[model samples]
Target: MTYDLLIIGGGINGCAIAREAALHGLKVLLVERDDLAAHTSSASTKLIHGGLRYLEFYDFKLVAEALRERERLVKAAPHIIWPMRFVLPHGNAVRPWWMVRLGLYLYDFLGGKMTLARSRGLRSSDAAYTAPLKGGHKGFVYSDAFVDDARLTVLNAMDAAANGADVLVGIAVESARREDGVWRATLSDWRTVEARAIVNAAGPWVHEMLGSLGVNAASNVRLVKGSHIVVPKLYEGDHAYILQQPDRRIVFAIPYQGGTEIGTTDVPVERPEDAQIDDGEIAYLCEAANRHFTKQIAPGDVTSTWSGVRPLYDDGASEAKEVTRDYVLELDTNGPALLSIFGGKITTARHLAEEALGKLAAPLGFRAHPVTRARVFPGGAITDFPTFLTQVRQTWPFLGEKRAERMARAYGSMLAEMLAGVQSEADLGSDLGGGLTELEARWLHDREWARSPDDALMRRSKVGLHLTPAEHDRFSQHWAALFG
Candidate 1:
């Protein structure tokens, strides 16, 4: 069958573009080689933030746009996206208070601030903000949002499919070529789909897709690998910390899945597939976290670690952190026409989708309306998150308060659908360890296109980080027997 567009890579960009196009009454197909968001999208710091440090590099416009997008996403997905207060622990080596205050002022006003709170100062003696820090530290609090990046991608694909787009996971695009007036793309799983246009939103594999299409465009992407480590919760409350290293790099110690997530070293990666957390990178993250927190963290304290390659645009920046996070679109409209995307952040993925659709409209003969701004994602159709939680509690009174809260945050209003016929805790099916019920696993496999146990445990749900090796192996055996 022929589609108006075939989007490669089921990451955030591809899913966003597919959703936009599908909502515009166009036939669309999205293909992902692995599970959606198995790579960079899931491995991010998981913040819908306007990089506060970007201001040091004079990335004002990028920060403003990201801030605006962050507000929109929080409003649209109240379940997964919520406001986060970041505490910038002051040190002698880091940028001074006045300069940091100026940057925060611009960040507050630049995005035409709405919904997000403005920056505030916390005194050294304030109990709410200063209890977890070491001596010789002041604090500044600023606004941003946190997100379940993997779930966000999955929900986007789910929204696209609900809007009549064909969402295919575990399908690799083996080759693509211009045939007559359309692009004849052969898929590894489904070999017979044609499209009027193709989008190379392959994240880190973007250049690889372009090369496979025989288009030797200029090298535009710089693969910088960033890694994160999850440790036991170090501080109280929802507020997180931003620590500055002696090397001028910064690390985030954010509250993650009931634990403290400290991360991200920017090291240039030569190969995308080979990106993994090495010993030195782990030491770097641990040391950075140890700098500000009173409790020191070692490699043994790390519960889990993940790595992702940022597909940043190469703008001759001397340092990887200085690379621009702004996206660039390359439209090849000569024959069948293909649009290639480079360098975008999770905060700006929706905007990038709108821009990409606008570029592909004329070529595909469809004018996509701006539905993303007001449209709700799969479970975000509800009005308020707290109200949705109350409703879930009423529907499944058997679930404990903590598990109910977790389910609402992860699946939103869809928790009812997930727990449809489940009456008692036993009716939810066998426990897959790590508090992951069998009903949730079935929902993932049947509806969310989760093929493997890793997809269920790792990307679809982060319970893998908490599961024991024996429990994981037992669950995997059951999952393979049922779904494989």
Candidate 2:
């Protein structure tokens, strides 16, 4: 099939671009080699945040761009993205107190309109907040946000598909060649698809993808592996902590899924798939938390670990940590115009998509209009979560408050569509372990392209976190039986 645009990679960037392109009246096709967000996009710190530390590297523009996108995401997907205060303890830190405060002030200012609270100082008397800290009498609190990163990516793909874009998962572009001013891409299964323009949003494999296309684009990807560990809950607050290590690298201890998630170690890697959390990275994360929190933890305390390679645009940075987090869009209009995306964060993906479309508009024969900027993702129509959740609970009393709230947050306005003609828990079909009903599982499969148990558990919904080993096995069996 011939498409106006063919996007490689189903990560946040690719999905966002697909949605944007489709919204602007383009026939777009997004193909991912693996499951949607099965890699780096899912492995993020799960925050829609401005890189506060990026200011140190004189990256004011990147921070401002990310902060603007951060605000947009919170408003656009309040279900998946919400503001969280980050506690940055002042004393016994790598950076000076003045510097930290100045940075926080700039962070609040850079983003323009503040939907969240500005930075403030926390006193020692605030025992509820200070009790968790091991040291440092004073601390500064600033706002960022938490997100279900995988779900965010999936929602973009969902919206793109809803807008008439073809989203094909588990399909790879094995080879591509310019044929009569169009990209003739061969899939892994030997099927061919043609597109007027091709977008290389392949994250870590940007260089490799270009190479496969036989395009001699500059290989500028610097693969930096960032690893995170999930451990037992460290503190009793809803707020998160950003601790400064002696090495000047900041690590986050976030309240996640009834546990604490501490990470990440920035280690330079040779390959894109080099996304394995090492022993040293785990220990470093544990130590980073133990140093600040009163409750000490070790490597043994880790319940889960995740890693992803950041495909930064190589600008001759000496260290991996020193690399720019900002995205670089390279447009090669020589033949069948190749738009290569080097580096980008989830927070700035929407804006990045807008920028990407702007570059491809003339070449791909489309008038680029910023439509997605005002639009929300699928199921993101509800702005007031609390009220929306209450309505969901009232509408489906059988779901109870907990389940209704979960549904409201996960599916938002689309909860009704999933629960249509259902009156009771019994009507939800089979109770797959951990509140994962047969109906919900089928919804994921039919609409979201969730083909396996892992896609349902890990990406579509986090119901797997509550499932027991035997229950997981049962779910797996049920999935195989239903799909196979």
Query: Considering every candidate listed, which one attains the maximal lDDT?
Result: 2
Q: Write the per-residue lDDT of candidate 2 for residues 288-308, one digit (tens) a residue.
A: 888898899989888888899
Computed on alpha carbons, the lDDT of every model, listed in order, comes to 0.86, 0.89
Q: Residue 51 deviation, candidate 1, in Å?
A: 1.3
Candidate 2: clashing residue pairs, number: 0
| Tens digit of per-residue lDDT, candidate 1, span 275-336 | 79999999999888877888888999988889999899888999898898888899988898
Worst 10 residues of 2 by lDDT: 123-132
Clashing residue pairs, candidate 2?
none
Q: Runs in model 2 with CA error above 4 Å?
A: none
